[model samples]
Target: MLTHTKFDSEAIANHITNWLHDYATNAKVKGFVVGISGGIDSALTSTLCARTGLPTLCLEMPIHQADSHVSRAKEHVKNLQARFSNVSSEEVDLTSTFAHFKEQVPQAGTQHLTDLTLANTRSRLRMVTLYYFAGIHNALVAGTGNKVEDFGVGFYTKYGDGGVDVSPIADLTKTEVRILARHLNVPDSILVAKPTDGLFGDDRSDEDQIGATYEELEWAMQQNDSGKVAADFTGREKEVFEIYKRLNTINQHKMQPIPVCKIPLNLT
Candidate 1:
């Protein structure tokens, strides 16, 4: 038996669309900048940005982004551009740039970049690309993170995908995001596609990296935060819940504001 959560997708979509508009207008930004990764979160966020009726730059910064992923991203952008005049897209492949950096940058003694470090660098490179367009267009970068990655498990690279000018879906859970995506008419393929950061340079689903399904993770999050692990939970459920808790604890720093040094009053 699966747990069912109910929400009004239309209402949520409307609220988020308005929120993006107001946030950008108040900041005097000209438009929204989004990195479309061919994932549901980015697909939904990009759609909402288009709904704002402001210029939107949907950038596909592929640092070895998979072929299927690139194709899906292009399809989504094409669909959006056809339906909305404000939406535009570009594909900026960074594979060569990434290779150049790895080859040219001097490595410290016994300090070569690890695979995870290189993956994170890929994300940071994408962030930089988004900001490059944003700076030129006077736009804000719209993040694709959902509540689970943004707050619960904090499963995002710092200053990478985590670095954004505004997060329109940060408050919505992964489950709710899918609901909203349906309402927004995100392409069926993207809506049902397995979630991934596309940072591995290979095909690796987010669940494979996280060690648990989003549904299980979401349940664990709600149960743990509620202070009541369900008495009827099986051994597997308990194990999954514990995994979620461990990840949430380990990655909590990603969810917090950057630490700032405060001077003593007298010293100041």
Candidate 2:
């Protein structure tokens, strides 16, 4: 059962940090590199990385970022740098870079696909930037995805935010992330701020796109995991369950390994 393990925030935090340090050490990397998107997931991920006392480099790659996102990212980076000497930050404004790429790509697709592809492009560009720094500094690209986003709804962009050398928080639920963020003393601004992917320039929220809140999504995920079906749920629960299932089904490609067609020995 999901509840088999009781929620001990401190122990969980320590465990994640220990795992991160061990992975980096075993890999012989100097430190970790993370894209700070001014969301709770990234905030918590970067904080956990800092606790390891490893050289953590936080990248604020804003491609037409909202002012609020920019402020919070800068705020978190400053606080982290002040708290940890090993923490450092560099801002790579990718607005021009994204525009340049758009100039070269075709735009004959539907408006919806065009918009989504561009947003995914933003994420992929940031991924490239993260690895660029990782290569130069010999650091791992730490992913900032939580369990719900990573597995439940598959809300993240594949080969974009989903791309990472190490995922420190992908196992933690969104609610658990908030609890641990409080425990970590993440700034009140970030703690209370609405969760947005910040991929679009506007301050739209993840819920705006998902049609359900994280709390509801988490509940739906649990019910689905326990073999609960549409017959078991009513009203909003049913709606959320359906939404969860739809996304999970469509995004199964992202959650699973790429399909490989193996040639038989006869063909060989």
Candidate 3:
């Protein structure tokens, strides 16, 4: 785990809240629309948006979601609405929609490949639902990605959860999100629950998919930044470094800007 040097959590929280408020005020949008995934990141994000005193819409878009995940999402929404007057929620069940989509697409692929694609499809469906609400409400889509997930591991779906109007917590680490979430009095259920993307309709966590905990990944990310390569450490450290490198290398397309082909002046 990354060691903290005792910074002010309240100040950071207020800063984010003010930043979100300022962004919305300037953008001339109504408020923020966030997808609640029953996870800490979304919980904290919705809370921050609510603190902005701007309208914050929390959408529960579940596609073959686990009961536990659904319940926790509901729990967070209820708690958020109770605490903030600006916060509101809606549940849009996407199970049938996903089934219909599967029927529309061809089914000539392998099961693993199909499952992975469908998992991404679930995220994209939620993205579509969020934008639909955002469009109707005239609000921006707030992203719930933390620094480790967004930058360190590239563990989000491009044009899905990654498709957002603003990222409030993208600079904060997973550990920092947890700490600030507690200070903001986020529900204990969310704070204590393991972190999972919940895209596969199972309880498998991000660590299960990434082969390392957020702490290990965070440390690896820092080491990787300091120009340290895999040859620097042996044992588990080396394994983690390689995993981090592999993910960062492959997911660069998501983190970087889209490629655009430019016509040369000679051709023009």
Top model number, lDDT: 3
Candidate 2 Cα lDDT to native: 0.92
Query: Each model's TM-score?
Result: 0.93, 0.97, 0.98
Off by over 4 Å in 1: 1-6, 105-113, 229-234, 266-268
Q: What TM-score does structure 2 among the candidates reach? A: 0.97
Error of 1 at 88 (Å): 0.9
Candidate 3 residue-wise lDDT, 2-121, digit = tens: 787785899999999999999999999999999999999999999999999999999999888898899999999999999999898999999999999999998646998888888888
Each model's lDDT: 0.87, 0.92, 0.94
> Could you tell me the lDDT of residue 248 within candidate 2?
88
Per-residue CA lDDT of model 2 for 16-131, tens digit only, reads 99999999999999999999988899999999999999999999999989999989989999999999999999999999999999999898569988888898889999999999
lDDT of 2 at 95: 99
Better of 1 and 3 by lDDT: 3
Regions more than 4 Å wrong, model 3: none
User: Which clashing pairs does model 1 show?
Assistant: none
- Give the alpha carbon lDDT tens digit for every residue of 1-268 in model 1: 2344557778878898999999999999999999999999999999999999999999999887788798889889998999999988888989999999889766644543467788888899988998999999999999999988888888899999999999999988888888888888889989888999899877799999889888888888888877865454779887888788888889978877778999999997
Clashes of 1: 0
Q: Go through the candidates in order and give the clash count of each.
A: 0, 0, 0
Best by TM-score: 3
Arrange candidates by lDDT, highest first: which order?
3, 2, 1
